[model samples]
Target chain A: MALVELHDIRKTYRVGDQEIAALDGITLSIDAGEFLAIIGPSGSGKSTLMHLLGCLDSPTSGSLVIDGVDVSRASSNQLAAMRNAKIGFVFQSFNLLPKFDVLRNVELPMVYAGVPAKVRRERAMAAIERVDLLHRVHNTPLQLSGGQCQRVAIARAIVNDPKIVFADEPTGNLDSHTGEAILTLFRELAESGRTIVIVTHDNGIAARLPRRIEMRDGRIRVGVEAAVSATTPLISPAHPGEEAGA
Target chain B: MNFWFGLLIGLKEISAHKFRSFLTMLGIILGVASLLAMFALTEGVARGMRENLAASGGVERVEINNKDPSEENQDLAFLSPGRTLDDAEALRKGAPLVSLVSPEMNLGNNTAISRSNITIRLATTGACPEYLEVGKYELAEGRMISQIDVDRVTRVVVIGASVAGELWPDTPDYVPLGEVIRINGVPYRIIGTLAYCESDAAKRKRAAGFSAVQDERRTRRMGKKKRVNRYDTYWQKNHAILVPISTLFNDFRTASNADGTPNWKLDRLSISVADLSLFEETLNQVRGVLERTHRGIDDFGFDTREEWFDNIESSVRATRTSGSLIAGISLLVGGIGITNIMLASITERIREIGVRRAIGARQRDIFVQIVVESGVIGFIGGILGLLAATGVIQLLIALSPAENAPVMTLSSVVVSFSFALGIGILSGLYPAWKASTLDPIEALRYG
Candidate 1:
């Protein structure tokens, strides 16, 4: 079974007596260990879709099965628990708690999960080591570089060993080299059998992933079969034999 | 999620905004201080009054006087002549509530001469042994007049401290015990000297001087009727001699003396009740007894320290009302300031709340966290306020005159501190509630 499944998902928002549809009857499924990118321009409802998929919000009308659990019907508390135990999120702005040190920021999710202090410290340290930020673990967000702060945020997201990791424009705030390094980390996480989903407006970031799902105006442009092109190698240089359009 | 953790966070927040926290606590501080200070002042006054009353006589004692309007209009002749030893005996027999009763007859006399020939006019009262207890007198030397003295009409006397000093100035160390003194050229043996009646002695002296001036004014007002009453003048000057009641009857009574001596009678009877709690009941009972004895004349009236004690409630009430008004205003102002600051804090922490909520914090958790933060501000403020009030009270006590200084007790500190803490918690509730009820999505969207 797919790790995340959306069946006829819909989301609507009320804006001053006007009902704006943010998602319209979207259906998708994501399997385990898939490194997927959802690409769209601003106001294309890609962000809204990401929010629904991350369980930060629910679909107005649809079934959302995350790891075979009906997420759309989950209570607020259940959704919070699911987010803490089953999913991880890394925002574009490197949303590390400004008052917390790198290690503390990484330990936050485990803290919320009521993990024992000893285990939380061990897991948080391991996550920081994974991000190559173990040496800067005592530094607060303000003291860290942009890339380093983003790494801390990523470490915080994954420290609880969540099954699915969601990155929303995760590399948008970084320089090209730093952005490439982040994408490389995502590739490594995916290779290690973690299901990684990246939402980006950058085509370069999207193209670097193994599979791409293009969205426009709250609708999928590439069909599901073509979108999951597993045969295609991620981060591959263009083949000389194939034309650019083909 | 842990209470200690929440408390630590709350304490951190308070430290982060020290000045704001202090201002919020200011109300509690002043409220507690004023409360304690007012209590101290009132307690001091009550204590002073009790001491004064006890010195004069026991607080439980009551004085009863004749209610005759005719007696009021007349001179000492009517007032003193109407009361007699027979009437005193009747009261002793008739009154059931009285534990002890004594009859006293005062003679207006001025001529008192010491063995050394020094003379001073001192007020004198003729009494039995029971007069010692009724007057709350203590003897410095010799013994009070005995029943034998009354029975034999012996010329034995107890002199006041001032009288003793004036009469025996040459021998300052001598206290006149078992010595002879002459009053109106008649010799009497000094039996006892009074102690701790100095204040009353001084007051009597001033009253005598005042009455003399008033008597002179009265003489000027009435030209023909202004006969100089030597007995009245003598009573005004010599106000410190006590003799047996029988002696007063024998030497100074109107019927006994052929020289037309003024009538010496009891004008008033002072009753001492056993228990203060029974004051009203005892007063009513005494009034009923007296009325029955006097044939429902309604000429006499009853007064009690009950009224004085009751008056304390009103004075304390006024103080408390004013205190409460000031405290209420301060708390209201403090509450408003705290709410404003907390609302700002909540607004600033919207994203944090959203983040916490998203990370599995229950609604109750959110609520508890915010409330805890606000309560912490109040608690710290209360402690600070308590310290400030204590310092103020200490300073006030230090600056006060020695006679009126108040001692601050532990009860005052506990009361002030708890009151301040209560105010803080009470003031912080609504704002914390408001913060806790925000929608996570909306909060996350807030700037």
Candidate 2:
């Protein structure tokens, strides 16, 4: 059985008198340990799909099954628990809490998990060490550089030992060298049998993943497809003309 | 999530905007401070009034006055002899609750007492040895008029300090105690001199810190092992002479009926009880005896003196209640200020809230965080208010009139501080709820 399964999922958002479909009839399944990317232009519902997969939002219709539990009927608290226990998220803006030092920021997920202080401190230190940011454990996010802040965010995401990790335009705010370093870290984690999902409009980033799903106008353009090789370089950047290939 | 974690988050938020947090807490600070001050002042007022009543012998004594039976019933010219010497005797014998019964007859104010060349017209009260005990009067130089004096109808008197000064200008204060003075051409020996007297105004000034000499004397007396009577030097205006009731009835009984029989009469009757708890029962028993002697006409009336003290206490209690109500309202307004500030904080920290939620914070966690933040604001405000109230109370104790000075107790501090905290929690609820219920997706997307 897949680690996550979405069946004919549709999400409609109302803006005054109009009805807009953010996710329309989307069906996808993610196997354990799969490195995948969902790619699209802005307004193609790529971000919405990321939100749904992360259990941050529920579908307006159809079913979402996470670890064989139907989450479409689950309460908000259960979604929070699933997010805490099974999933980790990295965002483009590197959303580390402004007041928390690196160690405290990384300890947050476990804090919500009700982990004891002694254990949480040890695990958080270990996670920070993984990102090579142990030296700056007491430095707040405001005191860190952009790349360092993103690394701190990554340490926070993986500190709880989540089964899967989600990155939404994780390298959008970093320089090429820093962006490359982050991608290398994600690749190393994926090689260690942790499933990873990246959402981006950047074809350059998507071509490196093992699996790809291309979306256009709230619908999947390429459906689910496996890469021919591990180091495939590029398909094309997201553009209006790319939809003609469907 | 742990409570300390919430508190840490709260402290961080408060420190980040120190000025804004102070502004938010100002209302609670003023409300709580004023509340404490009002409570202390009202308590002081009640306590002072109680002391006044206690000093005047109101708490332990009841007064029964005679009323003419013809005043109540027009059909009867005379029903029974009213509250007289016999009623006092009956109450003293039958009423076990009573500790002392003192009957008094006013020998007209113009009565003259002369010692050699000095003749002074002084008002006299004819009473027994129990008068000094029931009225709580202390003898300064010599003994009081004894039971033997009343029993033998001896012409003896206890003179007040003023009377002593009037009779002997050059003689020492001790000379008047044993000196014989002529009253209505009969020589009456002065057996005792009542304690020195001061008016209420003078005592008020001393208590208000106007008289340093009095304060020094007060402190010097405190070192003694014997308990000095504070009531002895309090606001009593003593200027009368005391004689035995039996002697007054024998020599000064002037009123008579148509048959020329001496009417057994008394101007007033004072009864003192052993305990305040038994005072009402004793008053009821005296009333019962009086009613039986007067043949159930209900012509006689009594005064417990509680009504005077009770009026002061009730008014003080009312002031305290109203003070608390106003203070509560101000705290609520302060709580509203906190709510407004909290809501603004939630709006400002939307992204932070979103980040926390994405990291596995449940709705309850967010709720606790915001509530704790508000509670911290209140807690700080309560502490600040306590400090400010203490300063204000100390200043009042230094500057205000002694009767008006506020009294701060430990319980008042605890209650006021807790009330401030309660206001904080109550005000924080709505804003915290609003923040916790926000959708993480929308919050993260918020500008």
Candidate 3:
């Protein structure tokens, strides 16, 4: 079953007297362990889509089923619980609590999940260790390098062992090398069987992901190769053989 | 999420801004302290007044005086002829509400001599045993005058503490039990010493000149009367001496002629009513009966400690009004201080509030947290204010004259602390509510 499914989702925001269509009848599905990148230019509604998928917001209309649980009709509190329990979010700005140390920043999601303190500590420490920030556990975000802070953000995202991780320009603030290192972490998380959806406009960043979904003017563009099936033998061979035979 | 954690965070935040927090708390502290101190002073003053009244006589007792216009112009000798021992006896028997009726005949120009020859002006009065109860006099030593003493006209007297100290200063351990003292050159035995009245000093100040003049006028008015040279000298510490009515009348009574004919009758009577609750009723009844017996002579007026107390209360109320006005101003200033501090705190923590809301903290949570923080600061300030008030009370007590010193009561502490806390909460409400209702998005965007 698809880990996440959206049925004809629609979202509209009232900017003054004008109604802006942020999401328009977009139907999409993604399975577990898929590393998909949603690529679009600014004002293309990709961030809004990411917000809905990450459970930070609900679609204005239509049904959304996350892991087979209908989330479109969920209450705010329920959505918060869902976000804390099943979804991890990585913001473009690496939104680490400035007052908290690296370890505490990583442990925050588990804290929100009401995990036992001892268990949260162990899980957070392990997550920090995975991000190679164990030595910087006591250093606040301001004290950490850009890549190190992004790693801490990733560590926080996965510390609760969420079913899906949403990254919105997770490498936006970092240099190319640092950005690559963060992308590697996303790939590692996806390889560990977590569903990863990244939203970014960087083509290089998008190409690195296993599947790329192009969004334009609140709708996904058609006529592109189905990136998810590109690895399957039938599609790759059929496309190349068709071209050769023609 | 846990209460302790929230409290710890709050404490840490408060401590981080120590001076600001202290400044915030200052309003509450001054407000509470002023409230407590003012209340203490008011309570103390009330107590002092009550004590003074009780010493003069319990507030319930009434004094009935002969108020005859005809008698007003009469000489003391003739005036005494109108008031008789019968009036006292009549009040005791006919007035059911009157518990006890003691007729007091004050003798003027008397002298008391101690063993050391110290002469003190005597407060010589002749009354029955009920006089002591009506006057609220406790016998510190020896015994009070009894009915038999009055009937037999015993030459016995009770000395006040001041008089006893003056006459018996050298006798370190001497208890003036059955000691003999000279009254008007006549030897009278000292039977009792009255306990120290709380307002003895005030009475001394009031009586310094007036009492001596009154005595002289009484003496002069009783022309050619057998003037009892009964000296009732009240000491400085022990203000007055009491003598049996018979002794005051017999030894002090003067003759109009050398032939031993009495010059004037002892007619003036002072009646002290028992059970002050019945003072008004008894006074009316006695007045009615006396008016009837004296043939419409409006020669009597009833006086009670309540009248004096009313006068004192009015004066005290004026002082209290001024005090409360001052305290009100102080509280207003304190409240403004609280508002200012809370507004500043809200401004400083806008971002923190935004972050908390972003993390799923509800507006109600934000509201409660701010209010709780303000309340906690208020409570702490209240405690400190109480301590400050207690210190002020102690200082006042130490510095005040013993007789007029005020006391701090438990009610004052509670009232002051609660008022301060209420002020704190009230002052904080607007600022805290303002802070809580800020839009999360806008707040997050705030610098």
Candidate 4:
């Protein structure tokens, strides 16, 4: 089943008397377990597409169906609910609130969701452990290195068991080695059948994902002939993290 | 977000900038303290004035004094001969509400009353029999100055408790019913003695000049507070001495006295009403009769305890209004300070707000957080203000003498505290709304 389906999505913004198109026309679909990356240069509207897919914003004129629910008419509050329930966002800056500790940062999504404290704690701990930063749960974001902050952000994202995780340059601020380690974490997450989408400018990282799409002038450069290739299972679900390091 | 979460955030915000928050709260603290203190001081002054009103002749008593006639009637003032027995007599006849009339000829102060070698200077008033009721005095023994005493110009006197005590200090039980006392070498018989009254000597020591009595017994009382709880509340009444006006006619010595014309000059005329509530109306009626007796010269003025009472009440009211206005301005300034700080804080935290929104926190959640932060500032300031008001009250009581000590009331505390809390919340409103209205996309990208 497709986890996200966008039909002719368009987003426009007006600057004084000029109308600018951030996302012109894009139709795309991603299966529930597919690991994909949307790659483009700066000003190609890839970030706008990521924002629409992540439910951080609504398209100006388009139909967005997430987990088989039509979210085209969702209000800002309803969009917020959708974001909390089904979508997780990882920003380029590893936007963990500086004042909160690692454990508290992981638990914030559930805190807004009104989840029980005990359950939120257990799930946040599990997500932190999955990111291999369980030892630093009590340390604030400012105390952690760039990669550790990104790991905490990832933990926060997956703690809710969201249907799709959209990471926008999750490794942009990290060292090359640290960036590779984060990529390895995403690989392991994908092998576990987690639907992960990366929106990045790094072509090398895009090439490594199971499916890849390129955007230019707010339009995806893809044809119908490659739909099967993009939708195919890229990682064997049975192995989980066996080939994570490889 | 839950209310508890919002409260935690609010408190954290305040703790983040402790000095700034305290400075902001100072305005509210002073406002609340001054507000409550003003109420306490005004209440005290009002209470003291009411006590004075009750002591000096009470609400139902009116005294007519010689007021120089107006500029228009200045020429006719000599024709009226000032407030006299004739005006008192006319009031007695014409004004039905004037229940008691006491025409007095005051012989000034420090009139020496002597018995053999011992003598005490006392305030002397040549009064009528009705002076007892009009002055709110009671005789312990013997008769008051009767009409026959006035008609015959008899040399008789009525004395206060302090005078009787000083004249015969060794004889505590003596009631000198027929004893002859001399006034500046002039002989007169004591026809009555006022009831014996004494208070804590410590109070009298503190109030050295308050009484004319030189009794050494006042200091014998240990440090204790006891009110006499009677009509003789004023210390002046305790030292009162009265003689018949006719007996002291030559002492006052109006120009008509030497000419042998019937002298009717009186220093003042006291009028009493049976109904205390009808005092204003009866005073007006008595003034009208006095005007008629003076043939519209307007040479006399009606003096009432109500004027003193009213002066106190109006002054207290003015103090309260101006004090509240000052306090209100301070509270408003305090509120503005909160708003200014909150807005600055929000501007600094725009990115954090965006991050929260991206993580699924709603605008309403952010709004609640900001408002709760301001509310915490107000709530804490309110409690502090209430405490500060208590200290202010104590300071006032320490500074002021007795009878005007400040009284702290529960209502004053509640009003100040609640008002502080209300100011806090109200001040947060615009800033909270400003914070919640920020666009997530723009805020997230803000530098």
Candidate No. with top TM-score = 2
Per-prediction DockQ comes to 0.35, 0.75, 0.18, 0.56
Please, what is the TM-score per model? Answer: 0.76, 0.82, 0.76, 0.76
Candidate 3 vs. true structure, TM-score? 0.76
lDDT tens digits by residue: candidate 1, B191-301: 987663433323444465644334444564566564544433222222358888787667756574466765655644666676677777776776666555444444555
- Candidate 4 local lDDT, B67-185, one digit each (tens): 77899988777777677777777877899987898888876567788999998776688888888877767889998889899989899988877667668877765788899998867
Evaluated at residue B35, the lDDT of candidate 3 is: 68
**Local distance difference test, candidate 4:** 0.81
> Predicted candidate 3: what Cα RMSD to the true structure?
8.8
Candidate that would win on DockQ: 2
Q: What is the lDDT of residue A44 in candidate 4?
A: 90
lDDT of 2 by residue, A94-198 (tens): 988888899999999999999999999999999999899988989999999999998998898899998789999999999999999999999988998889999
Residue-level lDDT tens digits of model 1 in A1-246: 778878778899999999998887677778888889888898888988988888878889989999879999887778878888888888887766676689877887887788888998999999999999878989989998999988887888788898899998998899999988888888888899999999999987787677777777777664422344443323213422111111
Docking class of 1: acceptable
lDDT against the true structure, each candidate: 0.69, 0.82, 0.71, 0.81
In model 1, the runs with Cα more than 4 Å from the true position are A73-75, A115-138, A187-193, A224-246, B35-59, B65-88, B102-263, B275-296, B398-416
lDDT of 2 at B75: 55
Q: Which one wins by DockQ: 1 or 3? A: 1
In candidate 4, position B44 carries an lDDT of: 78
lDDT top scorer:
2
What TM-score does chain A of each model score against the native chain A?
A: 0.91, 0.91, 0.91, 0.90
Q: Total backbone clashes of model 3? A: 28
